[model samples]
Structures are given as structure tokens and as C-alpha cells.
Target chain A: MTSWMKKCLVVAASAAMTVGMTAIASADDVTLEFQQWWGVELPDGALQEIVDGFTQESGVAIELLSNPYADTKTQVAAGAATGTMADVVGLDGSWVYDFAKQEAIANLSELMEADGYDDSQLSDQIKYEGSTYMIPVVNFAYPLYVNLDILEEAGVEEIPTTWTEFMDACAKISENTDYAAYCIPLNTEAPNGIQNQFSSWLWASGGSLLKDGKPGLTDNELLANLVDYFKEMKENGYLSDGVEAMHEQDMVNEFENGRLAFMVDGISHLTTIKKESPDLNFTYAPMPKADDYDGKSGLDVACWGIGIAENCEHKEEAMAFIEYMMSPEVNAKLSQLANAFPGNSTAEPDYSENDELFLKAFEIFQDGYAINEFTGAPTAEDLMRSMNEQLILYFDGDTASVDDMLAATQEAWEAAYN
Target chain B: MNAKLKKKLTPYGYLLPTIILMMILLVIPIVMVIDYSLYDNVIANKNPVFVGLSNYAAVLKDSAFWTAVGHTLFFVIVSIAAHMIIGMVFALILNTRYLSTRTKGIFRAIYALPWMFTASVIAITWRMLLDPNGVLNYFILLFHLSPEKVTFLASRDIALQSVTLINIWSGYPFYMISILAGLQGISPDLYEAAALDGADAVHSFTGVTIPQLRPILISLIMLDFVWTLQQFALIWMTTGGGPVNATETVSTWIYKQGFTKFQYSMASTGAVILLIVCTIIGIFYVRHQKAEE
Candidate 1:
């Protein structure tokens, strides 16, 4: 070989090594992508505020990816298959168990312990088999949100706390007003929403959808009673005739428009209602119980939390962002901004700034959560979804008996679980 | 390389990228779907356990699957019938001899408006218009047609038909355009010749027009049926196969099993079944085309 050729080869190798090392060094500073579903629903710039606060504290640039709630599962599933999931993503409470069981999400028990964070800081609903997969960041209970003015027009003096009174009030509203007395979201597009709404009623009647971590609809007398009660209500025209097609959002819009006397909705819907109609007089009441029950409401709690993907390359940075967001101050601020219940135990929503009507609604949430029996099961969401599909027949004015519905539900559950 | 071998290899060299792309995009995924259909993977990211034909057996035995197939078939039959009947009417109207070419073009473009919009957009628009308090009910009330609002998409008896109506409205344009093209191709001399034979408008339509349009109608109907079976966004957005699974179709059921319930293997089994159905339809289409020739 010529001397000049050998010299050129050595020079080229040196340059290539230097560029490679520089590229590797540049990749050390991590950027974390955070995927969530709240962007469009949240107040303008609210997500950016949280992202900005986290980025300032952790110095990790966050790429916020907002997916619609309906498409989150599909996107996450696709991401998992492609090994391209975001570093951190917010997941619904129902997803925690499935994601963790499949190791799609990173188990954060060690990370939490190392950071001096315990389960108490977040809700226990996110734990699957006693392992933490997500840090609870927002939690809320479903309640019967009422348009107080509509009730007044119907000459109803107070919100109902028992099933008998609730039905009576609904009848009064129907007779006296142009509005539907109560709105039932029977939209099958979101079987989860329908299931959650129905569970509150089931629980209010002192029934549980799950018995021994499997579906228990067959022998659950209270559930049967609830179905019968719903049938009677539908017969009396207290529920909307359009219930079969209306989604939870549609019902929420009706409530805001004063066309619905009562709607079973989450606390976060308050933010949207307020934005749309600031003068609308609305209040939240404990979901009514069955006539024989001891007047205990069975409002179920749903939690929203953030989890790191199992393959996240920036786990430390993602954890830091989560820690910053879950701090009491930020958590409380986000909760207040979204009108949601704070997931952090130390943080409390400030309702003192609101008017009397708003205060009444906020106070019901402050009374604490109801019995949540389904959270412990790994397949709680699917099992309930199966039952919801069957129960919707009755809810949609199908002539199926309580026995038939229960049998169908039992069949569906066995199909899912077995 | 030898001249003969080089010449023979040139065509394949040009086709290599497309062949590889097809293998990667289509053939491999289909194989994977078939492989997955034989496994018992319910949870995401978990190693699938081999289960042979168990997934298929379970799906075939499940009543919900049959219900979904029934619903899907209902939707397909109703949608295709409407598309053809209405589309033929529109095509005949546009093909009228009295209409100017410019007027025909303008009317055709206007009739194709629904085709310009995405299925999701059409679904949402129709949903808003059909809401209980929406414009349709408002007009119905305005005319004192009914004392109460009609729950068009919400009622069990009507939800499937409501979705089918929407699909027909959205899909008929394609048939209209295709059939119109087919009508335009038929020589006007044949119509004049039929006229000289004393055949009236009705006879000409049933005899020459129908026979001439048979090939296009058959192809369009087959394609429309397959597409309707796969209709997801419209039903998903409108009724979500709801009011007691009244609108549930096979595609939406697969979505529920795969995305919502995380039963990947069961979903794959459903997909494989749909593939078999589509393949059968394709075979019929090919044989029908050959017979027509």
C-alpha cells in the first residue's frame, strides 16, 4: 500500500470514531413523551401548564401526545406491538391491571420506594395483585348531577336519596316539564361508560357485579331488582326515549342544556358544563339507593394515572416528570382546574371560591368514595362490559326478563373468564 | 451475466421491491394473523400459548358471534339493495336524453357530495341531525307529525335501519357514478333501434339498459357487499352496535374483542373468519366476471 493511502485511512477512521462518540454523547440527555386523553377536554393551556411545570423542574423535554379516550387503547396496543410507546402515558384505572399483567407497563414499586413515595400517596385502585404499575394522579366518583332549576320548575323540593323518591321525582319532572326526567347513557360505543353508570345503581341497591373475582349477575337479587326498577322507569317515560343511542357526553350536554333533570356523570363534567353555561344551576347529590337499602349511595371511584412503558429508555426522567406532576401543589391545581377529585391524599380541592350551588356539588364529592368491589379483579372492566352488553337489552326497552338478562350475562362472563 | 439470463432477470429486478413490499405488508401479516388465531393470547405483550383450533371453536360456538354475523349480513343486504335501487334511479335521471351535458355534470357532482366526506364525518353529521332534539325531530314536531320526538338511532327496531340508511346515502354515489359510466358506454343507436322496434321506455330499460348494465351492477354490488361487511366508523359512531347490540356487526365485534377487551387471539379468529368470507366473495366475483365475458 502507498504511504499516503494508509495515512488517509487512519484519518478517516479517527473522524468516524469522533462523530460516533459525539452522537452517543448527545443522546444521553433524555426527552420523554407523555401521552394522555385530556388535551381537548382540559381547559385551554391546562395541559401545557402541567407539562411546563414538570419540564422546568426535571429539565426533561416532554413531547405531549394527546389521543382521544376512545382510541387510547388501540394506539397503546399498536405502540406495544411496534415497540414505540411513549415513555410515559396516562391510563384509565381499568387498564392498570391488564397492562401490568402483560408487562406492557413498568412496575413502579421499586421506583416509588426509592423515591420515598408509598401507596398511600396514590389510590389503591391502580394496584394489581399488590404491585404498583401506575401512579394515581386524578380520581373521582360518579354522582347524580342535577339541574336544580329543573327540579324547582317541577315543584320538587329536594333531591332524592332513596329509590322511591328518585323515581317519584323523575315522574314529577316528566309531568311538569318538557325535559326528560333522567338521562340514561345507553350508548354502546362506550360499554365502559354504560357499565360504570349502571354499577352505581347496582351498588346503590346493595349489589356487586363481581362475586369472588368473577361475574355474579345470575344470582344477584339486587341487580335483578335494579333491572326491574329501570324497566318500570322506562315504562313511565321518566327516562329519555333516546337513551338507547345517547352517549355519556350526549347526556352531559342535555344536562347542561337543562333538558335533563338528572344525569349520572363524573365530577369532571362540571368543568365542561360551567364553561358552556356559567349560569346553569346544577348540584351533585349522592346517587339514590333502593327503597329497602339503608340509604347508602354506591358511587364508584374511577382513577386516572400515569405509567411508564416497560421498554421506556428514559425511566428515570419519566419518573421525575411523574413525581413533579403528582406533587401536592400541582396535583391539587390540576384537580381544581379540571374540577376533578385530587388523587394525591394531601391535596384538597378548593371549593370556597365557588358559588353556593357549585359548593353543594363540590361538597358531595368531598364526602368521600363509595364501595368499589370491581377494582381488585384483573378482568373487572371486561367482565362488567360483558354484563353491560346484556343488561343494556333491558335498559334499551327489550322484553328480556331479569332472569334472561342474568343468564346472558353469566354466559358472557364465563366466555370471557374461562 | 449471459445475455439471456440478464434479459430474463430485468423484469424481476424491476418487480423485486414491490414483491418484497407486498410480502412485508400483506402476506406476512396474514400469516401472522393465521398463526395468532391458533394461540391463546388474551393479554397484550404476553407470550401466546398454543391452542390449536380452540379459539376458532370458541368463536364459532359463541352466540354473540352469530348475532354479529346476522347483524352484519342484515346491514350488507339492506345497504346494497338501497345503493343499487337509488343509484340506478339517479343514474337514469342523469342519463336522460333531454338533459344538457353541463347540467348532467353539475347534478352528478352535487350528488357526489357525500362521497367527498370521510365516513367519520358523515357519521357525526348524521348523528347530530338525528338527535332527539335535532333538526329532523324539530321539523317533525314543527309539522305536528308526531307529538313526541322520534328516537331514530336509539330504538332497537330502528337503529340498524338508521345506520343502513346512512350507509346507503353515503355509498350510493359510487354506484351512481359507475352505473352512469356504464350507461354512457351503451350506444344511443341501440336505443333508437329499440324505438324503431316499438319498444317503449320501460321495455328499453328492462331489456337493453338492464342487460347492458348487468356487468357493472354485478361488480358494484359484490364490492359494495364486501365493503359494507367491513363498515366500522359509521355504525361505531352512530349506534356502536347498540341499544342491545342491535347494530353490532362483525367488524365492530372484532374491535370490541381486540382493542377493548384485549382478547387478541379471539379477535384474530374473528378476522380469519371474515377473511374466509371475503375470499369466497372474491372467488364468486372472479367467476361471475369470467362468465359475463
Candidate 2:
């Protein structure tokens, strides 16, 4: 061969080799998108720190997409519909059934088995049709928040433990104080109030809205009594005014401003309360139960659940990210930062440096079993909205009777489930 | 290849990109939505079965759907009527020769402030203002207007009217701006002639101004009627059709059915019904515009 030809061939060979090496390097540098609502809820930069830790431990990079809770749900749903969901999505338990049934989310059990992940370490996995779809990373329990100053000013001697005592306390508080005795946000705009606040009363008294995984609101006596309790509160002017328009944040704002005596709210609000109103004397305790019931109370819970999109390209890296987040140490830190309970059974968040209210809330959480019937239910938000509408009508004195309201709700829920 | 054919096809060539975009952005999605309405459990189901017009029948049969229809009619009718009156008043004020230009400019800006804020911002601001413990209530108490606080957006009796008022506030600016432009275009000689004919100010207004602005008024009413009928974000962010479906418009109902309830077929049915209604109004608007041209 001629010298010129040999030189040109040698340069082409070198270029090909360089291109191949670059391609290999880029193949290992995968960037997964993690979409979630936890970023705003947690301490600033906390979720980013968690993602950074995962990236550092593994070479897989993460792109964090954070939005408010409702916005995130809508975006994720839109993405799911369009087959463009993020690689790692923060799921709500209520969304699990629909997502799993649609095959929008990956089968987490298969992913765990494929990765040889210890599934036993998880305290809760949102499952549908015998397969897990979501792993809860942190749990927030809904307990009753009491304003001690309001109680004191109202001349209430002790915290109420039974329905009767609770009513008495509400009466005294309404009679003696300028503040309302209690507030339950029944706003249909974000109607999870029916789940977190209203249905919690029934759950606290060891009642179930589901019988054998179906709509069980037809003849549930506990539910009827719970409705009656709320009606009584309304009739006696014990409930805070304008509940029809109040949202969860509104209730928290009232409590923080000391205009409310009691509210059944998420324990995660403890941090917000302390930050917003440092002087507000408040404490978290278990929700009041029925006087005749002596069973284990079921505390309502919400969680920051994590799942992998079925359309994700890099399943291995996504599974690794999930494993990293669910590891005991990481889960504990996340729970602590979020002021919630760890989703890992063995992950005990260190509360030594945390607020005392959190510690007390943790104890209460451990004392009661975590339950939210709306979780993993079919069209959960619809159920909440239906019940919320019925209750609103009942409160407006537009419905015939409590039985009629419950019957209407039962019909609506059954229609949705079917 | 002929000159006549080339000239004819050239216009189509010029319009090809827009036609393609309309097909992709508007037509295809509408067709898909209609198709979805003919099926059961669309996006959430792996294999959806075609259910004919069963979904539409179900939506029509729902009491809540009828309630929403009633509320939507009330909302749209009230909003359009109020917007027209308010817009006319403001436009007249701004167009008045009695006022200085600087004063008119300031009043115009002040009146247009509500339109500057987005639906979400307006919803949040009004929510705070209408809360029982809100500033309005505080003022009411300070003046002893009532013994108790008024739940403006919370009461069943008044939530619909409250949202309607808010809609009017946010929407009147468009009508005002349009009517002002139309008013400016009217020939002053017409009013002078009316005055020479022994007409008073009121007579000049009704005889000259109203006739001159009739086309603009018709167009504004039609456009605002469609827009107000589909008002979702304000009502969604405000009451969410709450206080027991007092303000449940068709748009909010469709949103709940689709996004919240995961019933795509039902939502699409409701949307199709709304589309039909709007299409009817659109036909009228097109005919009116054509006749004016």
C-alpha cells in the first residue's frame, strides 16, 4: 500500500475506537427522572439531598421533578395516559389500584425479586391483585390536635377519651371560649378531608368502610353512629363555621392561629405548626373513640409512596434507586426529615434531636394500627367526594335522614366500584 | 402543471401547514375523545369494550349531571348579563367626554386589574377574602353589620351567586375593552345628527350608540357565553362545586368524572355534550359575523 493511504486508514481506525469508547461511557451514565410531591413538604433541599446520596452511592444520576401534591398527581396521571411518565414516581396509595390495573406502574414485587431486594423489610406495600405496585417510603398518621390554651380557657379539665366526653368538651369550649370547639374541613374541592378527618372518626372506633374488599357502607352501624356524632356536633354549634368551604390547610391555619380547639389532622403538620406559630400550645393525641367500643383503634395514615413507571427504560437503575431509598438508614433519615414514620419496619428514626410532639405522635402511631380504606380502593377520590357531597347536603338540612344520606353514598360508591 | 391549476393549488400549499396543525392539535384529539366516549373504562383498562351511547345515556340520567346543567345555565346566563351591564357602564365611563384623558386612563387601569390576575390567583384571593374570618367579615363585625360572620363562599344559599359575582369581576374587562373600541369607531356625526333631530342624550344613546354597537355586543355576548359556560378553573379552585353541588357546572362535573373518578367515558360524554352546545353557539356566531361582513 501507498504511505498516504495507510495514514488515512490509521486515522479512521482511531476515530472509530474513540467513538466506541464514548458510547460505552455514555451507556453507563443513565439519568433517571424522579417525580414527587415530597420536595415541598420536606425541608428545603432534603429530597434533593436524598437523590444526591443515591447518585453518589451508585453511578446512576437522578433528575428530581418536584411539584405540589395535587399538581403532581395530575401531571403523573397525564404522563401515564401519554406513556411519558417519569422513571421513578412518588405515588399516593389511592392511585395504586388504578395505576396498577392500567399497567401504568411496574410490578414492584417482580422488580424486587429481580433485584433480590428484601421485601420483608418493608412495613407496607400498596398491592393490587396480589402484586405490589408501590412501596411507601414514609407514613404520616392522622391524630387529633388539641389546643391546650383553648381547653384551659374553656375550663376543660382533662382531654376527652370517649365520644360522650368529647361532646361535653366541645360544648364547654363553645360556651366559654370565643374559639370554635372543633373544625373538620369538608371542602369538596380537595375532598380528602372526608378520608383524613370524617372517616377517621369511624376508623378510630375500629370501624370498617369495606367488608371483604367491597363497598360496606350499607349497614355499617359504626358509620351511622359516626355520622350522628358529627350531626350532633353541627347541631350544637360545636363544629367550626364554614366547614363547607374549609380545606385541610384552612383547618391547620385555624389551629395555628388558636381559633380552633381541636382538629383531627396529620402529624406532619406538627413541624408546620411549630414553624408558623411558635407560641401555640398544642399537643397530638389519639382520636376519640366510641364509648362502648374497646377494640384497637385504626389511625388513618397517608404516605409518600414510591413506584417505577412501567415504561421506564432503565429498570435496573430504577430498582436500585428504590432500594437505596428504602434502605433502613436512608428511610429513617427521610422519615425524620418529613416528621413521619419510617416505611421500613426496622428503620427507627432518631427522635432525640426532634420535637417532643413528634416523639409523642410516634408513640400514638405505634399504639394504633395504621388504616386508610381509601388507600388502594378503586376510584378513591370519587368515593370521598360522594360521601363529602352527601354530608354537605345533610349538614345543610337538605337530606331526608342520615340513613338516606348513607344510602345515597352507598349507591354512588357501588356505582364507582362496579 | 398548468398555470390555472398551479394558482389554485398554491393557496392550498400556503394553507397546508395550518391545516395539518389543526388536524393534529384539534381534530384528532376531538375524534379520540368521541371514540373514548363510546367505550367503557378507556385509559385505565387494558381491553375496553365499546358501549355504544350507553355512556351518554348514563351521563344524561345522572341527577348530578342535571344539577350541573341547571347550575351552568344559571352561571352562564347571570355572568353574561352582569358582564354586559358592567362592561357597558365602565366603557361608557371611560369613553365619556366629561372625564379627562388621564382620569379615564387611571380608571381603565383600575377596572382592568381583575383581568390581570390569573384564575388561580383570583380564586385564592377571593377565597381568603370570603372566608368567615376573612377581612370582609372583620369589616362586617367592626360595623356591626350582622351579629355573626357571613360565609360568603361556604353557604349553600349564596355560594353560586358568590362565584357568579367573581366570574363577572374577572370577565367584564374583555367586554369593556371590545365595546370601547367599537364605541370609538362610531361616527360622531351620527350623534350630532341625532341631536339635530331633537333627540336627548338618552335618545341619542339608545338610537345612535346602541345601533352602532349592536354587532360588537352580539359577538361579545356569544363569545362570553361559550367561555363562561366552560368556566372550570375558577369554580374548581374556589368551591369545587361544593356546598352540595350548588355550583357544580358541567366543566367541573366532567373534571370530577374523568380526573377524580377515573371514568373517562362519562367525562368524554359530558364533554361531547358541552361541545355540541358550544358548536350550536359557534354556528350562530359564524352566521352573525358573516352577515356583518
Candidate 3:
């Protein structure tokens, strides 16, 4: 070998060795607790397997603990006070206010900047107190999930195109079959998992959350009238027996059992139905409008979001972990689990990588059949959850008239606001 | 005495482990509850801000809190009375040897079914039976007893009573089982001796049977009273403390305030009031027992 060539080879070999060690030493190891409510539909710890790849790449260990449904908020509170909050936490979008009231969340603007989560992607509609506190995970729009098998079996060729036709169709389904037209769990929390669907109903019926682009939650003629119609629908056997106060899954189960023709519920439930009863033939449709702009008029959406706790000891690590979660590749891995549609627009693979019921949810989102007031005037949510609760009374025969229900509800709304 | 002292201490030593467990499990949570009760501890947020005795004062002034207390007390009084009366009556009938012990045992087992059933299932079962088109309504119509469906649980006046019926049904077997054990403890000779004196059923019940069963009855009634007072699930599951708050009990109200409304301060206030009411009742119970001693 020439002496000059040998010297060059020796220098290159030493440089390559130094570069390999530098790469090895730079990867820091850290563990993050990721808190969420674990449910049957969560797919046997599918999320853990999904996040594990991110840990492998980033060298950050993600320890997952599925908090119980009702106790999650309290557990998070305790976790925060003791400096034990999961660095990244999942919460029901509806619960954002209660958490925000306590400042249980880390100020996200700082973290979002470092994580490359910018404010421009979040609409002003979702901002709270002039700041966006949520990173949306699953954007759930309430829609009617019809057992197409039963609808077609009844010789019904078309889904109802309008609100009146929908009720008429329900009447036909009720008469022709043992199935009651719809199953509405009159006594459930957030009645039927999306009383937001009722808001969609109101929108279709010429009512809006507001007349203008503001929170017109109350003092709307059309909205109040929509409540009246909702009560009447309950009274007239449009909503079935043994349904009031039934849990959401039981409502879906009754549908799967072919006992109900229609079930109005969340978009996230697409995977739920497929896993729980794959044999059931169901199709999703936005609530039909009585007028052109009802559902199309405005949007109602709720999504589970993760926020950094305010006092996380490892704040930077938490932000890094959140940024990793939003990465296109990492989100794709989690999306493959089909627990939720990932927050990233570019991360659609987490949703579309599979060809199961998860595809159905994405299809609806693609069709623009979704809306959510993820953040709005605070009083709107309390009013919405409550009026739905009162809707149960109309089914129970506790009130002789819809006016009675509305008057009482208005009193409740006024009381809540007052 | 010194030897005896060590033997008694041995049982306490055995109890030491349980005491530690109770302190860790029950006492600590209770102490935390008391601590949280003194402040407004919003989950994961604001440091607990102590506003001493205000939660208690606020709960005292809130009419809804008082209404819940009234409903809870009403449930306890009515349920305990029904359980004691029905339980004592069942015990008296079964006390006789007209039926063999084996036959009596089968009957007891049959009646014991509801007690063994879960509270949630019991609530759901009763709700169905009481619904307008439910079994009870079907029977009522078939017999032409009432012109229309009662809608028993939907009516404000009827909802509390409807749940009380279920509560009585859920509770009687436990009381009967307890009083039956008390019944067996009474010497058969007392009944034989009473029979020799030609004491009729009523005469013996007022005299010998009642006196012998008094201690167990007191204890049983007190326990049932407390249980019924704390009752939430059955009423909540069935009626959701609704029909315009007629069935709203203190426990459900606390849950609604604390968890549903996120008003931990308000829930704490309600808790303090509930504790006070329970403590007052407990004092009366202890005094009653002391007088008997």
C-alpha cells in the first residue's frame, strides 16, 4: 500500500469510530407517565404497544396507567399536588374547563413552541382565556349510526333525507319490526355520549348555538323550540322503553342486538362497534337537516386532548415527549392501534393505515361531516348536559308537557348561570 | 392476672396488623376527607385554600343540602321500620316447630335470594317491574285493579315510596337472618314454659319474645338505619335522585356536587353536615344501648 493512502485510511477509521460513540452517548433515557381512562375498546393495551416504538427511537420511556372513568380527574389532581402527575395526560374535552379552573395544566405555548406545536394550527374558536390549552387527539362528531341491515330488511331503500322524513321512517321501522326506531339512554351522563347530536338537531331545525358567530347558548327561540320537539319525540315512543338512563354501550348493544333501528352517538364509536360486534351492519350519517344549514350550518365537535400538568417536575421532558407524540412517524404507530384518530393532520396514517371500522371514522371526517365547539363560552356545556338530562323526564312521563320541561330547564340554566 | 394480661394482649397483638391496615386504608382516607373538607382543593390545580368552618356553614344554609338530609333521614326511618316489623314477624312465624327445620331452612334460603343479589341488579329489576308496561303494571291491568298505569317511579309523590318498597325488599332478608339468629338463641324452654301458662301468640310476642330479641333488634335497626341513610346506588341507579329531587339523598347530592359539578368545597360542606347528622344519630344509638345496660 502507498504510505499516503494508508494515513488517509487510518484517519477516516478513527473519525468513524468517534462519530458512532457520539451518537450512542447523546440518546438520553427518561420515563414519562401518560394518564388516560382505560376502557374495554382500548384494544388490550394497544396504545402501549403503539407508544413503545417512540420510546425506542427517542430513548424516553412512556409508563402508561389507565385511570378509571370517573376517578380520573381526582387522580390527576392528586397526582399534580404530589408532583406525581403524568407528564402528558388525556382528558375528556368537556372536562377541560374544570381542569383549567385549577390551572392543572402546564402553560402549553412555551412547550408547544419547543415541541413545534404552533398556535396557527389551532383556531381561535378552541382558545380558552386567550390561549389554546388542548392538543386535540380524537375529534368526535355526533352522528346517527343506523343498522343498515335492519333498514334494508324493512324494504327501506333510502336513509331519511330530512328531519320529518326521519321521524316518519322511524315510525315505519317501529311498526314493521320489533325494533323501536331509536334507542336514547334518557338517564345517562351526556345523554347517548353526544347530546351534541341534539345541538346538531337544533341547528338543522333552524336554530343555532347563536344567531351570530358568538355563544348564543340561551335566549334563542329556535333552540328552545328544538327542546320542545326533543321532548315530544321522547313522549311518542320515538325513543324506546328501557332506554332512559341506560349506559352508552348498552344503547349500542341494543342496536347490535337489532332491538333498535337508530342510535345517535359519537364518531369515535366506529371502532367500538366493529370490535364489539363486527357482524352488525351499520353506516354513519350526520343528523339530517330540516333546513339546508342544520348540521352543515354550524359544527359541533369534542375531542380527547392531552395537556402538560402545570407543575410537572420534568417539564422539558414532558414537552419533548408530547412533540414525539405529534411526530408523523410516531403518530402513525399509535394510529395503527385505532384507539383514536391522531391529532396531526399529516399523521392520517394512524387513522387510515387500517381498513377496519377505523376507516369509517376517517371517511366521515374526510367528507367534512363533523363539527365541534371544542371551546366556547363556558356556560354552554352545562346548559347542554342539563337540558339533555331534562329530556329524560319527558320520556319518564314526569312532565305533562314540553313547556313544563323547558320552563324547568330554563330555570336550571338560569340557576347555573346565576 | 399477669398471665391473663399477656393472653389478652396476645389478641391485641393479632389485632395490631388489622389496626395498621385500617389506619392505612380507612383512617387515612377519612382524615384526608376531613382535611379536604376544610379547604377548596380543585384537582391538580390551586393549592388547597383553607376557609375554616365555611364549608359547614355554607352547607347548613343551602336548602338543597337540607332537602337531601330530610330525604336521607326519611329513607332510613321508613326502611328501618319496615325491615324491623317485617323481619320480626317472619322470625316469629319461623320460630314455631309447625314446619321442620329443613323446610324452614329452604324457605329462609328462598327469601335470602334478594339479599345476595347485587344492589345495581336489584335497582334495575325493581325499575322494570315498576315501569308502566312492566310486570307489575301488566298484573295491575289484568286484574283491573287500577284504570291506568301507575307510573310509580315517574311521579314525584310516588318515587320515594317506590324506592322505599325496593329498599324494604332488599333489606328484610338481612334483618330476618339476623333476628332469626337472635330467635334461635332464645331457649325453647321459654316458649314451652309460656305455652304451659296458656300464653297466646300475641301475649308471648309482647312479653318473652320481644324482651329476648330487644338487644339484637336495637343493633339490627341501628345498622339498617345507618345503611339506609347512606343509601345512594339503588335510588341513584333507578331514579337518579330525580322527579324534581324527591329521591335526592345526601350521598348522591355530595357526588353531584363534588364530582359532577367540580364544587369540591360545596361537597365538603355537604359531607360535614352528613357527618354531623350521622354522629347525632350515633349518639342517640349509644345512649339507647347504655340505658338498656
User: Residue A273 in model 2: shift from native, Å?
Assistant: 1.4
Compared to the true structure, candidate 1 yields what TM-score? 0.91
Q: Clash number for model 3?
A: 13
Q: Write the per-residue lDDT of candidate 1 for residues B1-293, one digit (tens) a residue.
A: 99999999999999999999999999999998898899998447477789999999999999989999999998999899999998999999998989999998999999989999998899889988999889999999999999988889987778888899999999999999999999999999999999999999999999899999999999998899789988999998888778777888999999888866778889999999999999899999999999988
**Which residue runs does candidate 3 get wrong by more than 4 Å?**
A1-31, A71-87, A114-127, A149-157, A188-194, A203-207, A210-215, A271-281, A292-300, A350-361, A374-382, A389-418, B1-61, B89-159, B243-246, B291-293
lDDT of 1 by residue, A1-418 (tens): 8999999999999999999998887576567888888776687788988888777766678888887787776687666655687889888776767677778888788777776765576644367667788776876677777888999999999899888898889889988998888766777777565456667887766678777777677888888888788778878988876877888888888888878888877776666677788989887788888778774455676666788898898787787788777878988887777666677878876756544545665566556345566553555566666666666665554635889888887886777556
> Each candidate's interface RMSD, rounded to one decimal?
2.3, 1.1, 4.6
User: Residue-wise lDDT of candidate 2 within B42-80, one digit each (tens)?
Assistant: 888779999999998898899989999999999999999
Q: Listing candidates in order, what is each one's chain A TM-score?
A: 0.89, 0.95, 0.79
Cα lDDT of model 3 by residue, A109-161, tens digit = 76677766654533222345666566765455566778888787666678886
Structural similarity to truth (TM-score) of each candidate: 0.91, 0.95, 0.80
* 1 versus 2: better lDDT goes to: 2
- Across A209-263, the per-residue lDDT of candidate 2 in tens digits comes to 9888889987888898888889889988898889998889998999999999999
Q: Whole-model Cα lDDT per candidate?
A: 0.80, 0.91, 0.68
Q: Give the CA lDDT, 0 to 100, for residue B242 in model 3.
A: 62
lDDT score, residue A241, model 3? 59
Residue pairs whose backbone atoms clash in candidate 1: B241-B247, B241-B248
Better of 1 and 2 by TM-score: 2
